[model samples]
Target: QIVRAGAPYYLPAKIAEHVSMVGELLQFPRLVPKKVISVGSPVKWANSCDARGCANLVTPSVIAQRYKLPDESLPAAHQAHTSNSMAVAEFQGQFWKKSDLDGFGTSCHRDVSVAKTIGDEEPHGGIESELDIEYIKAVAPEIPLTVIYNGQFSLLKWANQISSMADP
Candidate 1:
């Protein structure tokens, strides 16, 4: 039942994907979630929990980060600072207006490339794989960039993925 909730109790590298895949393969979504009338035996619904709002769930640090100031301050440093930036207006007028985003791209655009090159091939560049960094640069041009490379034995693979997608 805990596996059904996609909860990894100890490690982040749990294979919950396979479990979910098997559940889907067996048409479990259509079969499960029938609320019962009487239950003397031990039973638990995976997603049974109190509903939470942003006020209850968010932290002070998260609030600060979410409402952080833009790179360049605008006319007034209010909540609408980014929206009121002159640069944004100019960018919108010159670049955004001219470009046809009718079929520009989807909200989530990603390109993943793997390299088998040895780690010590180029020590001058940071730990991040050069091929991967270059791929991201070419794909998402003219934006703030941060690259994070992880060792093969690192525990938090999710953090590595998050760092790669940090800019976007």
Candidate 2:
């Protein structure tokens, strides 16, 4: 399962909380590192100082090639990376309206259409950047693999909480 936090950019701390909650509810293994994919903006990192933002710097092609994928496979990987960059640009242009850091004040709605679009673009990291689907197809050819994107509600809630706490 590709476990990602609910949106609009859920804080790391709250995501931890949700993970714990879900783990407890399902009696699943507590905090397995391999199962989680932190696709949240890398801007939260202390080392990145670039102004172009997180999406621009994320070259999935470079990453895919790093995995030793063949040269012919590079084109699709590049396409996926370019598509992801475009999607991010569109999202920021359309959604990020307020100049203030905390523009949406309260909880923000998840754009399901956009999320589905991104999923449809298949930005998974593999030979063709369609790794997730391709992997499942190869391993369990008959079984249907469904990609579920958890909305960013918990993320937005956590961000609001953080902003509120910072307002001292």
TM-score of every candidate: 0.21, 0.19
Clash count of each predicted structure: 0, 6
**Cα error, candidate 2, residue 108 (Å):** 29
Lowest-sum lDDT 10-residue window in model 2: 103-112
- State residue 89's C-alpha deviation in candidate 1, in Å: 33
- Model 2 ranges off by over 4 Å: 1-22, 25-56, 73-145, 150-168
The residue ranges of model 1 lying beyond 4 angstroms of the native Cα positions read 1-122, 125-128, 157-168
Model 1 Cα shift for residue 45 (angstroms): 53
Screening candidate 1 with a backbone cut-off below 3 angstroms (N, C-alpha, C), the clashing residue pairs are none
Predicted structure 1, TM vs. truth: 0.21
Over the stretch 1-168, how does candidate 2's per-residue lDDT look in tens digits? 645445544348857765522221122346756765767754422212223443434232333334564443335422333222212211111222122112111111111111222212222222222333333222222232333222233444434433454321
Give the lDDT of residue 88 in candidate 2: 22
Any idea how many clashes model 2 has? 6
Q: Give Cα distance to truth, residue 138, candidate 2, Å.
A: 17
